[model samples]
Target: MTELSAKYGPVFSFKCGQFDVVVINQWKFIKEALANEHLLGRPKETTIPGVIEHASLIEMSGESWKQQRRVALTVLRDVGLGKSEMEDSIRDQIKSFTEVIKSSEGKPITVADKLFLSVSNNISKLVFGQTSAYDDPASLLMAKMMPEAGKMKFFNVQQFMPIIANLVIKLNLFNMTEIISHIRKFESHILDEVNIHKTKNTDDNSIKDYIDGFLHEISKRQNEKDSTFHVNTLQRNAALFYFAGSDTITTTLQWMMFYLVKYPEYQNKIREEIKQTIGLNRQPENVDRKQMPFTMAFIYETLRHSSLVPLNILRRATEDTKVGDFSIPKDSLVTFNFWSVHRDPNLWDNPELFKPERFLNEDKSKAIKPPYLIPFSGGRRVCPGESFAYLQLFLYLVSFLQQFEISAEPGKDIHLESVQNFVTRKKELPNLIFKSVD
Candidate 1:
């Protein structure tokens, strides 16, 4: 798509099966298209089989999307998403993660599983009001399931041609049978959790987690006409929260570790910055980010260079719309090619280089996050967990660097190449050695 954009223009339209997809590569047009109300609708046919049936927050449109988003934001805020309480929970998980690292002393360790468990536990706590043990079967199952689910090709094919894809799904072709079964298992798990939450007697004031808050909303809106609150929606929303919340953060953190080992000098710089700003005696706090400019710059650079989510989720035009003179007919699929923006030479200098100083200011004292760097995306459909993810990334990186020096295993090479997925791009795992700083 970026190659096509180079020859065709920044904004180009192409046919994918029955859908006309408009790919916006430049930031100016992406910003415009995202803000347009007509382009905010998600395509109904693009939804995968056994994945909420177009009813969850990611697929829903208009009034239903608004109501669910509002309720979710409210619930997230009330449940300590951006608060100190959430930070403490994340820190607790980081401590467990460090312990897992320590246990692998003098041996090469693959951080994916342990890291996934730590990140998943945090999301589990937010949704279920409790964290799971690292070795818990359910937690481990999800940790294994998410990356496997990402590897399925069915998700990619469905985006362009849903009718044939649905037929293929019905026929159980393309190894989708296993993926669908796993998705069903996930749905069943969420349903069980929802039922358990329902069994508990709780009121609005007693709302403890996301399920509790959502249930309270459902009860209050039951009297209203055509209310979107119900068991199915709740189940789907919880699944979305759990899957998306954990997978993206875990992938980003893995990339962070990959870069730490690939560029040991920058790792030393970040460690030194951490030592000067936040000594090893105390855990890193969210507020400490303000004082550590280079660390923050490094984080921002990782987000941009990794480009984990190269393209925003496919959005549909509800009506005819114009994005920078390109006419998008009704129901046309529109996507923002963030990969191009992040790597565009016009927008960034030496776009291929992994330079954290690009995000630093003239004096190198403060981090200057340019508007073009939209890893969490932008506009109304921007990631709601942006703040939460940032907090987790900052705290995890700081805490881990404070305790250990990460490097590739002896005779092993670290590769920055990523395996592309339907939604996210995951790094190729490499066994790492974490030498204790103590």
Candidate 2:
């Protein structure tokens, strides 16, 4: 990375090949830009298809962004983050996931769709009052489009015309109708959850979820002279939280299982460790993870090698900032390029290997791992549902490995290629033989 930056940082203004791109890792400048005024929800702009949309806050300058971002972070904290109830629900959801798969009686399965159903359901339970039932029309709609959305940047009317871009976009008649239909459907789902939050039972701590807390916020600022906090923003952020958090983590877990089946040696090591640590019939808990070090390392290696969320977060510079020798212009896009850094040969011994041992330390033949892995990402936009994701991921993988071992089908391709773009997973569904270990 140092070598690449030395040769390319200045040349970035030219060779990076995009108007808003800032190449390489610049943690301080990037973090500053997130909290800065230059792009914190101000003068909006247009983005063509095939890119990640710069955050809504990336347009505001100075004081406005500082104020808005503070509100956003505060709201996230107020909601149930890293709390016990959410993790408990996630653990339950994975158990539900097992029941669903077990009904199929060890048949080869497309576990991604079902696992996403459970994870997304758990997220919805936390964010709103209810979860999406499997086979719901709305669930099917989003599932179809999520991969499409990630493959290419669909139109973003809000970024272009904050006020009436919907009206402006009407000039295009045909495609505009489809876009509007999807947007309304999306908004309607969120609005329904907003309403549920409004009516939550305040009498019980058993309420234990985001909606109850948000309803409290609605009341908190109801009498305040002018409050930036609104039911609308809370609703939007809640929907965004569930969608963003569930997709990437579940996708990575599904792919990890795919690869585990592909490489039986790795799967056996993980299975052996789970058996030795917890034996059979015991559920995996957060504390038990320390006992399953090899299994934990396997998941870590999967996160790195899969590089599912391939791009570092999109940060638009708020003020003129210096990172390395180059000057990053205000309001320009500042990308962290985690893909590059994660794969950097300088930092890793064999940058492309699937070895999980790199993360374990013991005798001379052993390895040591770092704690600052940013798979859930970092900074303000780092996922608030990260704790839930950890529970879902750990329990789902550990449970699946403990009960039934998966293997690629005979005469089928074991080297299943992955789908890629902003984030990714296996293109081919991992239909595998799940022989019961019990």
Candidate 3:
């Protein structure tokens, strides 16, 4: 994609089946497009159970989209999204997380499973008003299938040939059966939770969590023709919250460990920063982030390095829009290639190098976040969970480093290549030996 973008220039359009896709390689073009309300609608997503018209918040657009997003953000904040309540919840998970590592007894251990459970449990609290047990069958299945689900990207052949794409989708020839089944089962689990919330029927004025809050909205707007606050929408959006919030953060924590093991110096540097700022006896808090600039820099660098979701959630033109010199027709699929923007040579010196220092200003007292360093795409449609994700990463990374020293397994290579999926992730996840720092 980088090479092709270089050849065709920053703004280029291509056809996938009957769908027109415009890829924006440069940050400037991406910024312009994201800021335009006319280009904010998400492109059609085919993997979930429902019709594309009833898209989840991540894929929904226009007034309905606006309502869903506003409701979600408001409810999340009301329930301690960026507050101390959220931090306390994460600290509890971190307690269990460290126990899992301690059980390894200083041997090499795979951390993804524990990380998934911890993160999923956090999301579960927000959406279901309760956490899924670590050993719960539904939770385990959902976590196990998420990485595989990421592989179910839009059918490449469908882009250029709409008829064939439709035929293939009809025939299930693209082999979406397994993927769809997993998603259905997961959505069903969420539905079960929503139904439970309905039965409880908590006071309309006092909502328990997102499910209860959504039910209140549903009942309040039952007469509206185009209401997006119904049960099915709740189920789908809950699944989206689980899938998007959990998997991305899980992959990121994995990448953090990978970089810490691969580059021991940065690990030590981050540890020293944590120790100096919060000390080893106490866990780090989100508030401490301001005092630990290097720790924050390391996390930012990891996001830039990994570029998970390389091609961000696809958007479509709600109306004809002009990005740069190119005219994007209404309903055209548009994507901001974050991988290209993050690695653009013009943006960073020696763009390929893993230098957290680049994020630090000359004085090294603060982190300079360039506009191009958009691990999370910007504008109104920016990741709603940005602050929550940042808190999780900050606390988890600091807690992990404070508790143990992680290193690559003896006699094994640490390959940095990533798997090509909906979210580009490390192809090889190393089980590093964890030695207690104390």
lDDT of each: 0.84, 0.62, 0.82
Tens digit of lDDT per residue, candidate 2, span 1-438?
335556765225432333356654533433444444433323334232212132233333355445545654554555545556656766777777777877776677777667778778766765665677778787766666565556542123433233554554557523555555665687688778666555555445443456566566557678866554466556556656667767877787777877787788987888888878887688777778767778778877887788776665455665786664567777565555555556667667797777788788774233344633556566555544566566667778888888777877777867757665567666667487777786
lDDT of 1 by residue, 128-178 (tens): 888888788777888888777777642266656665776777787667778
Between candidates 1 and 3, which one is better according to TM-score?
1
The top-ranked prediction according to lDDT is: 1
Better-scoring candidate (lDDT), 1 or 3: 1
For model 1, give the 10-residue run with minimal summed lDDT. Answer: 45-54
Per TM-score, the best of the predicted structures is 1
Residues 118-180, candidate 3: write the lDDT tens digits: 898888888888886689899899878876766666435543454465566577865756655
Compared with the true structure, the alpha-carbon lDDT of candidate 1 equals 0.84
In model 3, pairs of residues that clash are 16-159, 16-160, 17-159, 17-160, 17-161
After TM-score superposition, the amount by which residue 372's alpha carbon in candidate 2 deviates from its true location, in angstroms, is: 6.5
The clash tally of candidate 2 reads 15
